[model samples]
Target: MLIGGGHSHVAVLRRFGMRPMAGVRLTLISRQAETPYSGMLPGVIAGHYTRGEAHIDLRPLARFAGARTIVDEAVGLDPRARQVLFATRPPIGFDVLSINVGSTPDVSVPGAEGAVTPVKPIDRLLERWRAVEARLLASDSPCTVAVVGGGAGGVELLLAIEWRVRHQLAAAGRGAGHIRYGLFTDSAHVLPTHHARVRRAFARTLAERGITVHAGSAVVKVEPGCLHTADGRSHRVDEVFWTTQARAAAWLRDSGLSVDDRGFVRVGDTLESVSHPGIFAAGDVAAVDPHPRPKSGVFAVRQGRPLTENLRAALAGRARRGFRPQRRFLSLISTGDQHAVASRGPFALEGRWVWRWKDRIDRAFMRQYTELPPMRAAAPDAAPADEMAAPGQVPDASMRCGGCGSKVGASVLDRVLTRVKQPAAGRVVIGLDAADDAAVAEVPPGRLLVQTVDFFRELVSDPWVFGQIAASHALGDLHAMGARPATALAIVTVPYGIESKMEETLTHLLAGAVAVFDREGVVLAGGHTSEGAELALGFAVSGDVAPDGVLRKGGLRPGDCLILTKPLGTGTLFAADMRGRARGRWIDEAVASMLLSNGPAAAAFIAHGVSACTDVTGFGLAGHALEMARASGVGVELDLSALPLLPGADETLRQGLVSSLHSQNARAADAIANAARHAGDLRFAALFDPQTAGGLLAGVSCAGAEGCVAQLRAAGYPSAAIVGRVTPGEDGERWRLKIGD
Candidate 1:
């Protein structure tokens, strides 16, 4: 699975989606649904385009490519096990893994924590923009905005905001001078890193916009309402945006991967991670050598084709080709007003038409994925001239089967096990490859039996991500039951491949699964492996939930408040993901949500007086909630607006997107009190959206609901919330999903 849906990886996803590798499964893990294109962000901020116009949809890309999508952040890597562990969900196994998380702004500067918002992540910057805009709209006063760093990003952003604020003011019948903009840099001039001609253009633009440019001024501290410079100069500001020095994500430095001084992954020309051949790095997250290039989206975009090629080769155990980056690339910098400056080497040009050219290039790149070519239909077979032919073309083939039906065929499993030796054991009664119905274990008199089984097909294509989700999903059963996991038996199946390919596939998958088990004090008990046409995993786990304090699904009571530990919508998101229509940031957000295990949430639920609970999985909120309500002989009134949905879930549903399993889930909504009333609401549809490695749905007392949610959020389950309440059942049959006011 590709981790971090940044620019480079988005390109890789699109290319792979168009023409996938025959036997390879692709998955993408990201923290956001829409990854903003840096090149168009200024245009967006300047009001020339909307947010959607500047972002790439990762969900549709994954769907179109038949890849799985895991929305999560990778926490660590177990190279030996070929697994990537996430903070939330299970560890993901992969034959090949790639990282393109991109860089974070250097917010480590003094006093930056409270004073400035970093622009590197893009999301934070958008939020800051909202806050600034709101404040300006709330009063008839001028707003002062300060931007740190005088590089291309900083200059462009300052101008964009200036133009947007002024435009908004004029639209509101206010004076254009209602907003003040400033740019600060620890350099002799603005755009110090660019050519003199480029610098001159930016200087002229800033002057025309009446933006104050502070050169040779080093910021020492960021105060609440002002930035204090090293020379004891303080500039008052309503909002401070960070666009200064950029660096790799902090997690990369300790990930055991080879990194440069700035902590970016060190990669060769082929974009392979320096220390691990099976791992690759690209985009702003990677530092390429032989020609040290600046951290620009251009290089990341160019590297996508070669990176995808090398990943396929690496997985196939073949020699990989190198990526050759252009020595010089055209730089088209927007002026936030339908005009732009173009620079090639030392040469330069500027005009409104240049901006139009830049716009066409950016839009065309986006269209390649959005407006995909339809798959060509197979030709009809020849028959006698008199034979009648159908007037219309045949319907496209049905999508591949999913769930249990997608399991590996029996013959393929047996053949692979025949060549492997079994582990030696004295007391072992059941062994892998024995074709037994259930695993057999010896139970001593004093020891109690703890059993948990987890099964799920690939939700995403990236091996590492699939490994994480699989492991996390397996571990959830143990955590839910309050068990200290003892050991795990993995049942993994990969697409058929050569010996080396099989080895790599098994290695990465086990690595990811093992990493999760290892962290939970569990051992890898011997299990089975086989080849199939798709990837799937199941774990028969044993753990010790204290005999005196076992948590079960049938413990809820009336008068309890319902709490959800994480956001919903993996099903709808993944459905959209398949079409390559979901945005990168949305996929990222989904994966992050999935990777988050219910371990912590479970503990908090129990401690906070949780009466009953169940992890929200394939059946979704309404389906699972119905289960709890029926089991407890109580009725639930779910506040639809209170639902914590994954990013882009509502939008996707509004667009009529849904998971393959959504129909079955919607059928289960018959238990709902007024399903028809919410039949047309997109937000309500998400109530039936199937989830994988989702959150925990708990029932707590109404009085403790707010406090419990606060505690959960404080304990790191930030998305936790009180989604509804339980009450005495009306006729003891109906569960209601109320769209609250």
Candidate 2:
């Protein structure tokens, strides 16, 4: 498992992409979907490069590398359990782990965290930079911006910010003369790590720009609008940006890993943790004890290949190799305009040509990830040998038993259940706590019991997220019938692995389901677990509804308007995602839509006097809508253009990417009168794109339809819209659906 989408990890992903290892399931856990290329950050700040050009999207990269990515921050590490803990999800196990989570600027000063914005974590910095530009553009008064730190990063960042802000103001027809700049550092000179000549050149440029330099002054305290230095000097500033020395994440030291005084993981020449085996560290988060080097992107980029080799060696149980970082390397620092300075030890050069050269180098490095070649399927005969837990580390698949032997071990199952926070007993009588063979639930008086079952193999690699989606999907049926969910019984099939691995996977999956159930006030009763070739999950959900309040698909009237509670196109988007053709943001939006429970929308529909209701699920919109229409004994006219679509849906459909069941669902288009005429349209194609955990489709009177949609949107179903209208049908209407403009 890779912990961060840092500079080194991106390289590691690229290498693994070019030549993937068989049987080694790679997973990347990152805080953000995209990680900025530090080398091009100053260029972006200076308006020389677009943000997209300076950032690498880890989703496509991870998929191309045959790796699953979990977009989350790692909060802690359980060395004993070999698991990585997350704040919002259950812990995930990793056989071999690597850490490349880069550092943030040291914000140790009093009140600094609240007053000064650190210039690391370039994504957040860029967001703040945009705000700073907007604030300056709108201000008519003089504004003083202070930068703390004397190193190359601080100097370059300050100049870049100044240039961008000034340019923006000029474009807005505002005077930039009111803007002032100040640089403070404990070091006696700027570019403290650079050659003396380079420092002198920058100092001269700063003076020419009228920027004040407070050398040998350390910021002791920072207030909202003022800062105090160690030398008893106070400087009033509008905003303060920090670009100080890097600091490690606090969890590293707490994880019992050997760390330096500053909390950075200590590693040897091989980049492996000195205190722990099977764990590696790199990037700014790691301090090489054998040969200490300054924390810089260049070093991290250089360590990528060595880290990959060592990690692969460790995983394969081969002898590990050592890597010694170079003592000196070339540095190219841009001056926020079209010029830059190049320095290598005592050698220094300054010219616009230097900036062009640096730009070329940076873009080339980024292209390795952004301009990846199309992935090809492996040949049958050329497939690499399975490396799943070495040769004899686990029981052979053929030798494994069947029947009751396939069930998960009792102790492992118990441990997982003990840790999982099951939903509170609301309607459940004999639940998990009772350890009964069958779960028993009680139905409240005057309410009828409603039950539905759903099961599917993992579409997503993260068990935690998949669990949530699966549970939400099963519950979608209950909501469609206008029922309040009361209880759920899980059915889990875990891939064969060691006892501990099985426990961790089951725990994560259950925890995710329980999180959704608890939020919806549904109890998780007893369930079953069994070994399988692939991970799968399902739930038998039970709900309660008043007999008079239950909504059905056959209640639609001729004048009713059809309302869809969410967007379509999860099918095409995820299919494209599997092939690395979809963007990260698109998948993110799709996941958000899937996680949105249809319960609120269902309640809103019922409140608005909805006549009929059904959820858009695996059968696609066309099939489900046809089912509703046929059952209501009426025809329907759907507005092709009115259908809401998820992001990137059209692009994927146009590329002929779709879920495997799309063809089967498309057969329902025969029920549409204009199927042939609109066969080529992407929107028409979307009608047949199967969805997972999708929205609610309902029929409401014309007057109440608009109000019902309004209520749904206010309740968080923003895409809810009237997509069609029910029409009067004859006794034998062969084609009951028609597409409208």
Candidate 3:
């Protein structure tokens, strides 16, 4: 498992993508989706490069590497249990772990936390910078901006800010003289780690730009708009930026791994943790004990290949190779406006050409991960034994059994069931609590039975999350029929693995499903589990409904309003995710949408006296809507512009990224009256985008439509909207759908 999306780890992903290992499941746990390229960060600040151009998108890179990504912060580690703890969710187990989370800016100075913006976490820095820019654009009086650090990062950043802000001001009809810049450092000279010639070059450049340099001045304290120096002098400033010494996360010191005094992991020459086997560290979060070097992005970038090689060896149970640090490396410092200085050893050069050279190098490095090469199909190979087989066992398909022999071991299933909490007993007569051949359930005398079944392979890597989605999706059918769910039987298929591994997987999957069942008052009756080539889950759900209260697709009335209880786009989003084209935030939002239960929305619709209702699922909105129109024997007119969309859906569809089921669902478009005229719009594609655990589409009385939607939004269906209205059935136009503006 990779712990962060840092410079080194991105390279590792690229290399792994080019050459993958069978049976090795890779997972990345990161706090953010995009990681900034520190070398090009100053260029971004100077407006020479856009933020997108300076950051690496990790979602696609992980996909290309065939790795699962968890966009969460890692808070702790359990080396004893071989698990990594997160800020949320259960701890994830790993066979091998690597850390490249990078370092944070030292913010221990008095009042620094609330007063100054730290420039280490590039995402946070960018957010704060945007706010600072807005304030600067609105200010008319003179303003002072101070950078607290004399290192190369601080110097280059201050100059970049000055250039970009001054240009923005000039374009807004303001004078550059209204802004003042200051550079403070505890050291006597800027670029203290660089050669004397490099320092001289930057010092001259600063003086030429009229930037005040307060060398040997340490920031003792900071207030809202002022800072105190160690020399007993107070400096008034409108903003303060901190780019001081890098610091490790405090959790590292307590993580039980050998760490230095500064909380950085102490790693050997092979980049493996000195205190723990199968654990590796790289980037600013690691301290190389054999050959110590300063914390710099260059070192991080250089460490990529070696780290990958060592990690691959570790996983294969081979010896790790040592990596030696270079004595000197090239450094390019940008001077804010397409000009830069290059220095190596004692030599220095300055010109616009240097900046161009730097840009080429930076962009080339980013393209390896961003503009990925096409992936070739995997070759037929032997089943992997690393994670699949236990001691003294081998993975061989010929040795596997058929029929009842394919079922999971009775002992394993019993243990997993014991570990997973069973849902509270409901209408279930002889369910999991009893050892019965079949589940028996009873229905109320006054209510009719509403039965629905749904099954699908996992769309996500997290089994727990997948379980929630599967249960929610299955329940959607009953909710659309306005029934109260009572009992469910789960069908599970897990990949062939060791008994212990299979047990753990079953426990998590059952636990996730049971959580949803307990909340919805549904009982988990008995189910079946068997070994398979991959993981899959499903449920057979049964519910109760009043004989006359059943909501169906045939009750639409003329002039009724159409309300969608959730946003569209799970189909396209997950499709894009598989192809490595979707952003992490987009997938995160989509998962959240899928996990939402349709129970509340169905209740709201019942209360609002809906005429027709059906939950949109595998069939896209177009197919489902057509089903409603055909059943009601009416022609439906849908306002194309009014349809609600999930975030990133439009862009993905525009890029032509769609699910495999998309083409099948689009056949429903043939029933549209004017498909040819509106097919060009990207929103038109959304009409046929298949969804999982999608929202309910309901027709309500025009008088109650507005209130129904308002209440749905208040009940957590924020995207619920009036997408269209029911129209009168035309004799020859039965099942017809109209697309309108």
lDDT of each: 0.76, 0.88, 0.88
For every model in order, what is the number of clashing pairs? 66, 0, 0
Q: How do the residues 437-482 of candidate 3 rate in per-residue lDDT, one tens digit apiece? A: 9999999899999998998997886677788889999999999999
List candidate 3 stretches off by more than 4 Å.
Answer: 176-178, 208-210, 379-391, 414-449, 484-488, 511-526, 542-549, 704-707, 710-718
lDDT (0-100) at residue 131 of candidate 3?
Answer: 89
TM-score of 1: 0.66
lDDT of 1: 0.76
Clashes of 3: 0
Ranking of all predicted structures according to TM-score, beginning with the best and ending with the worst:
2, 3, 1
Preferred candidate (lDDT higher): 1 or 3: 3
Candidate with top TM-score is 2
lDDT of 1 at 309: 88
Models 1 onward score TM values of 0.66, 0.95, 0.92
Q: Any residue pairs clashing in model 2, and if so which?
A: none
lDDT of 2 at 299: 93
In candidate 2, which residue ranges exceed 4 Å CA deviation? 378-393, 421-424, 729-735
